[model samples]
Target: REQADLQRVFPDLYMNSLSNVLTQGMNRKKKHEVEALAAVVSWIARSVGANTVVDVGAGQGYLAQVLSFEYQLSVIAIDACSHHGRITNARAERIKKHYAAKMHKSRSEDRNLNMPKTVTCRVLSTDTFKTLSDSLLQKDDLQKANLTGKGVGEHSLEGLPDGNVPSCCVDSKPSLLLAGLHACGDLSVTMLRTFLECKDVKAVVSIGCCYNLLSEEVENADSQCGFPMSKGIKSAGLSLGKSSRDLACQSAERWRCLGKDAGLHNFELHAFRAAFQMVLFRYYPEILITSPAIGRQGKALRRQHHQRILESTLHHEESAHSSPSLSQKNCKKKGSCPTMNSAEAGTAKNKGTFEIPLSDTGNSTPKSCGAADFASSILEMDALFRGVSFNQSTKCEATKSVDKYSLFEKFSRSGLCRLGLHHLQDINFAGLWKETEPFAELIGPYWSLRAALGPVLETILLLDRLLFLQEQGNSLEAVMIPIFDPTLSPRNVALIAKKI
Candidate 1:
């Protein structure tokens, strides 16, 4: 209910001290997530007296391996992706072999190098949400388990070598701890519902990610829904739009690495695209009929433009007689270089600048006609579009109408097939620059403020799931805990609930 660090919530669980051989190779992010989630699940298992764990969306069986091998718990890892099951099975075998080798060395007397049934990977035929009830423990599965055996008993490895392990279901109700590490979208919600419906599931530790993939209740069935689980929030009509949900999934660590300048560049890039759209609108009035989805294509275009600009600046500075090699040397040494400012760019004669006029007037004035470099840039842009096999008719029209978009129009139209370009027809370099300067200055802080509120959004979503659990009446107590270091894993909070 209140803010608490992950360590504060699970103090008993410690990191696994893996020897060199047993240290399975994984990236730093994965290593941290596995260690932290293992600890939390270990703690939850102990608290609930649960030995069997059901891991949904178990990619490569990393968490399952931790629970079964490290924590000495029985685990069934389920994923809809069949390919992942093969990888999981392979990893599980490797870990088992490593453990066996270690055990054989320590105790030469015991020849029973039989693998532990620490974990089993299963490919789910049903949807991820239906996995709990439809694909639970079977009778044959219980037989394979040797469930009656004492602590740390050897589990059968009969069918694992070929990756054909059957789903194990218990006839009598057995205690279960359901877990999902970064279960995307509706999968996490499914786990919450499973804990409520299935009495055997004693506790749950769900850490969700990819909020953008979540289905809106109004648009989807109750079974398929991912948001507005709590009655309070549901009654208040709370909803996170696609963009907001996508924003919620952003990592703070990545933001810190980008710093202020790169972030601002990205913001300014959007306005540039918007202005470019206006240019297209003037030439092609048809573009205004609908709103086209530019999406990441605009970002890519902006990045290319930015890169071209940098190259141009470096080239110009390098060719100058006085500062012939100064710019090049400085850029190479310090990874920093002077770039042409917008103010200077507007006045530069032979450099590529946004000096293209919106008017079709045949005036000889310099302001009415584009610079040679600008015209060349437009030609280069057009060549790039042609390289991608974009529609030639649209390209011809764009070129015939305006010299500025000679090549740029096809690139923009290829990505944004809708009508948004019409509005940008009137926006020119000077006016767009004037409009974007203030916006560019303020956007960084605005995005940061929005990012600061991400945790609150995460909290609300997790709490809603917890509230749903409480309302189920099966779970005695349901609470959300910060189970991982926030700096390491942005989506660190986990919803944990225990049965009566």
Candidate 2:
């Protein structure tokens, strides 16, 4: 059908090039998946004899482009990505060229039988729905406001007549709709809801990914889902299931167990080491030298690196205290003597008098350290020591925690405390759990509930599709095939309406 349509709609020049290039530069693996799904959908479409198809979340338009060109079906491809839409549009244009060439070739053999080759392919952004809807309503309001000599204000359209609304000329009912290869979060949900609301959308096929970004609860009351949606369910009200939640919980527990098994003494250090290792593996795959083979061989190098880092940090600390600044000298001249080292400075306040060694000035008087100067010097020393300690500790713990679980725990606990989980008191399980509860409350159950509901909401939307078709006087025979996927876990569940 697509080939026939292409022959009629495209010019000779473009069609020839499109057909020639169609087979070129195609990835066999990806094309096979497309072909497999397309074959199933196309067969069903043909059996149903549906002429129009809308592909929702149609990334790059590969599936829609193929269907439009090959089946001569009118295709509307919608996606959120502008670049993806453009790519699809470009592909459609090429398909048009390919069809035109076929028509030209066939013209010589058959003058009487002309193919009606008008295949309309529209690449649309998801926002196009809102924009189009708004423009339609606005146009009617402007016309009414014009008669009253009151120019339409942005807010003025609130009172427009329903009849004056602009209608999208595209069929209110389409034969088939597809959301092929939809991405993370709400995109899949949006497509499913679109299927439910659009009465003309007869059939839908969708593949969804990125389960993590979905919202657990509907913050926006005016949202399409209507009910309070959790993170798992799509905006359309599809819930994934309890099993998904169980799996997620298990995965998290496994991660925690892994951390514990590493024998990290500090919970803070263990957590940091685990996270750092994951990130390092992801971003710096080459730097991962901790495999059994390398770990055994690189022991000397690792030790040397560790020593060098320690030496550098100690040098930095020494340099910080070696020279007294001009302010310190001025304080000294004002009879505010410097404290002798940190230990002496710490003990001087309790003693009530701080003794300071003065340069030999041939005078019999000994300089005494003022309380204020002693306190200030102690604070400065403490700040310097803490800063150096934290930096060095974090780096060391991140690198070596895997080998020494005790060190990992210390670092992880300290890190967690900074993040506001203070319960990691002694790196034990009890302390870890106590510290983790608040943090868990902030991000855990809420997100888990949201993720688990995704498949459920999908199921609901799919049922809604079936119900919509039934209301339209179409039996299950005509509409059910496209929406069914055996591979989906929650199979055999159908939408059944009861008298209650």
Candidate 3:
């Protein structure tokens, strides 16, 4: 899809109308989304004659604020996270002041901003939407104009107070338009279901992320699964296991954009993480069942790795300044001396092929790794063995025996310490690296090819959503449009539908 698709479809009423004040706190990527989406949805609300636009999963109220203040349309900002609701309210106040100043409106005149009503409630099922419809419609809205700031509410759907009314308080029946930006997993699917079930909900414009987190019926028959929302897939028994769903979120463009050094570093990190599963399997077998995910230990390892280099550099500079170092003098005479480069040192190993022995043959032979299978297995292993608490570590002999695994030893020890594995006194990380290191060079090429398949999964999932809307009967119109730059926002397509 072209980046200009959004701009082309809606020419006269579009992104350019946004100001710096409106776009504050948004980065380039977010700014692009808000500007493009706000314009299109604004035009949609107008075209469809929707009085109130309800933004489901409205984090920080960026889109809601734009619709309420700029477009002068009433809006409801609903989010499950209470903190997001709190933040959205705070952000709304700031934008109100900006708009007031821009338009030269008095406190009494500020009612024209039509500040979005903040609702902090979970949209778990269609039942929530039914309750929301009742709560909003049942309120007395004649005094909404007079209430203004007083009417801006953080009300729950269970009940509304006489003193508190909604900012989008309607005198007549409401035309509810549902929306979500990066609504997580089941929440996005929940919105589509709501749109279909609730008569009051006339339209829905949704963009979702976190496919990995989406509930699957195959995983658990009890919980409602977000996948296979379309009847066609449900009948076909198509289930993308969480491992593959996580892979669906990968970006081909992001990988392509990486420079050689950065890319290779990432590949090494992946190999180390895969090897981490071996550590878990050997020392803490039971922990795999528990699936204890200590947050971002890989990222922690990366941070620690960089910190060591920085500290070493500082110590070397200080030593050079304090005294006439022979190494420094020799380095000046013979150009800059290089630090140990693992890739260069392992040139011989990289060329060697790795293989898993076949059970019947009882012979070892070189085997080419299938990129998809390798990525899937590695991802599943990481997911299974994650959050390992290897709190205790034995002194690694591998780092001293062979310099290749010095960094790997650090990574493994850090991982072991996190998993609290103390009894592994003779864990030979070098042997494990020796066993698996031959496959390290193959990771970059294999993973790159695997990453390309991400969109195929994404497309099928999106198609399922589209088919769901279509199968609901011809009374509703549905379309999935490529609205934003896919490179900037990988989940760029918006699922939009309007009931006839």
| Model 2 ranges with Cα > 4 A deviation | 1-20, 23-29, 106-165, 168-178, 218-500
Clashes of 1: 10
Tell me each candidate's TM-score: 0.61, 0.38, 0.72
* Tens digits of lDDT, candidate 3, 1-500: 44556655656665556788878899888888987788878877776777678898898899998888777878888887778878888888988888778677544553566788887777778776656655565343423323223234676543444434334434666787888888898899988988888777888889988999887775343345688787777877788988788888888766776645446667776787777777777767898678755345545434444444446446556756787465355344311221212322122122343221111111111122344333322332232122111111312122222233544554565454455444366677778888888887888888887788888888888898999899989899998888888778878889989988
Ranking by TM-score: 3, 1, 2
Model with the higher TM-score, candidate 1 or 3: 3
Which candidate should be chosen as best, given TM-score against the real structure?
A: 3
**Lowest lDDT block of 10, candidate 3:** 357-366
Candidate 1, which ten residues in sequence have the lowest lDDT sum?
387-396
Every model: Cα RMSD to truth: 12.0, 20.6, 12.1
Q: On residues 152-257, what C-alpha lDDT tens digit does candidate 2 reach at each position?
A: 1111223345454455445433234443453344554554444445444445555444434443434554554422233333345544443442332222222333
For candidate 1, write residues 243-356 as lDDT tens digits.
778777877655665534356545544544665566456555565555444555434444554555557546655655568466455434321223433332223234543332
Measured by TM-score, how close is model 3 to the native structure?
0.72
lDDT of each: 0.57, 0.38, 0.66
Best by lDDT: 3
